[model samples]
Target: MTAADQPPQGGRGPRRAVAAAERTRQPTEVRRRLIVDAAVPLIAERGYASVGVRDVAAAAGVSVGTVTYHFGSVQEVLSEAMVLHIERYYTALSEAAEHATTAAEALRLLVDALFTEDTDRHWRMWFEYWHAGEQGTDEAFARGQADRYAAWHRQIRALAERGVGDGEFSCDDLDGFTTRFAALADGLALQRLRQAPPLTTQEARHHLNRFIERELTPRSPL
Candidate 1:
């Protein structure tokens, strides 16, 4: 055998060591997710603009090089965090909606879910994204915000269409109704976040229910 191919005198060769290390190392995708999970909560607690790779690395219990190796840049990390946050929020909404018997009930459940203490951090993160978009500091974040709103619009529109099919709503224009509902919900959420005589959870629910009642016929109890 060639000298280079020969095993070391006292221990495994460098190639064998490397192969063993690779076998024991976490998968690339798992490592990436670990970094992302660590980064997101920090970004939620402190705005994305305030977080750095070192902070993420420390939180993830990995070296800065590991974070850099998984995510090319801080912006990419922030983007991935935003995506994960949205996914969680969407899943919660979907679960709430699934338990409702009517579209109106689903909408009410969704609003309730949005205003809970658990969702407060998410809302804070969401507002940070909005602020970043307005300042033109991060184009990717801005685009992501727009995409999230579009998704919200589509979801609301589907619910409104279902309500119409059930003969619960009087609206002929589902699109307009969906847009108005989303705008109202966003306005209320912003007011709550500002906490300037912050809208109480019950008050927000009352207003949303009132609006729905105005638009939809009351379903008779069976």
Candidate 2:
């Protein structure tokens, strides 16, 4: 057949052997993982722009060229890190989504998980992304903000619909109410993280519960 399509003519297949050797030599998955792992703590601490390829390479114990080889640019690395963070929070949200039986309980559980003692690190990570989003340098950062808000809204609307079906709440505007409800939870979460002697998990849940009950409790059994 054609020279390009046929096997090597060296009779030793040295070319194919070398190509296979090079393929084995390349650390594809390991390099990608190393870049992502090294990026998270650095980006979490210094941010996306402040850290560069050399910095990431140094942190990863690989050469700067290795960093560039794995991720074409620092922005790409940061995007992957942001994706990892999103998946993490989403997993938590998914777990909370499952445990919540009622709409009110779901909101309460979600708030408690967000503000609880063990979640401070996640909160800090989220805060970092939030600041990045404000800068608007990266589209993924901006999309991340929207994705989280949308996911929260979806869960809240599900809860609202469930409440309505159960006769536990009255709402003609599910989207509007869900947005405000999520906003309140987010506001309280920021306060809980920012304020000294942060709201206890129970306290945070109590606050949200009261608000939900007040808004949802039917007046005429509707």
Candidate 3:
């Protein structure tokens, strides 16, 4: 092997040695997932630019070869990490809305969950992947991003229809409103992702809530 790819000689790189044994003991699929999971926080904290395969391997408690064995390159691993992380985000939004009887309550739960401290890492990870994939060189990443956007738009449209049914929201053009709202949320999320960002999470939610009140929610009778 090339000197650059050589495993760390003396010290365990980032994670503990005891966990190394457990990391390798799992089935192939499980080990692959472990590597993806390790990459997410590393990407979130370090940014995709700074994190290398070696960093991921150390974090995953696996040898560099093990990570390469499962994923051909670091980009592939990071891409999968984005996929898994985003899937959980969508699932969380669904779960948050499940308890809400009114359309307004469902929206409040989704917006609250979307911009929380816990989800800050998630937004970071997403922006990192988005920056990397925006050039369209990564075909798989491009396709996945398109699919994810479509899914998000669908959810927004569904909620808008439900709002109409519950008499909580009204919009002359549901499709146009859905697009505008999705873009608004995306902009707010990017603002929140900035380092030392001026936009606080609460402020992001407040802006979104305000949009709902003005654009979607029906005003009281005069």
Candidate 4:
């Protein structure tokens, strides 16, 4: 039912009270999600420096107080949003990993997902965070970058092992492979984010595939 259908609390009768209570419960969950969804793109697109508390509340269709009551600060709201984003990212990675039959396939899937068209918001948000962190004014931004990189490093390491096992890669230095691969993804994203036309999803996939192939190819028949 719509908001108008819900009974008012302490305004009419017991039914109104019950309806109001139910409505309140429903919105608590919903408002939180709305706040997060609104905050993500705003902070990502505009950067935290340019946006304000009122803007977020307005975007979410809530008041400034409601935003403060739920998250206390813009930093807190942004931090929680990053957490949610990473959780979704990891879940998608897990599913891709499960469906992959070979290490090459798994590695390709991981890179493809990293450079996926769906990740534009992520790339933008992450780029903003990196810029903020380098400014030295936001410790949270710096820590968030480090934490995300660590998580990606772990995933890449696992995928690297699988690639080696399937003879898709010749690298014995799995740690080195993971670190460099993760760095390559980040570097390319940063470059493309600043370049013209942006990098197409297929172009990203091709670049990643070629890089992997080059790394895995053996020199001669030694």
Top candidate by lDDT? 3
**Per-residue error (Å), model 2, residue 195:** 2.3
lDDT of 1 by residue, 64-155 (tens): 87788888897777778767887788877977787889888888887787776677688777776666567656676677788888888888
Tell me which residue pairs clash in candidate 2. none
lDDT, model 2: 0.71
Measured with C-alpha atoms, the lDDT of residue 214 in candidate 1 is 76
Total clashes in model 2, counting residue pairs 3 or more apart in sequence or in different chains: 0
Give all candidates' CA lDDT scores.
0.77, 0.71, 0.83, 0.73
Model 4 TM-score? 0.75
* TM-score for each model: 0.80, 0.70, 0.84, 0.75
For lDDT, candidate 3 versus 4, the one ahead is 3
Which parts of model 2 have CA positions greater than 4 angstroms off? 1-30, 45-55, 196-202, 218-222
**Off by more than 4 A, model 1:** 1-24, 134-144, 217-222
Deviation (Å) of 8 in candidate 2: 39
Candidate 4 positional error at 123, Å: 0.6
Compute the lDDT for candidate 4.
0.73
- Worst lDDT run of 10 residues, candidate 4, spans 213-222
How many clashes show up per model? 0, 0, 0, 0
| Range of the 10 consecutive residues with the lowest summed lDDT in candidate 2 | 15-24
By TM-score, the candidates rank as 3, 1, 4, 2
Candidate 1 TM-score to native: 0.80
Q: Model 1 Cα RMSD, Å?
A: 6.4
lDDT of candidate 4 over 43-131, digit per residue (tens): 77787578778888878766687788878688777766666676677778868886999777787778778876678778877666566
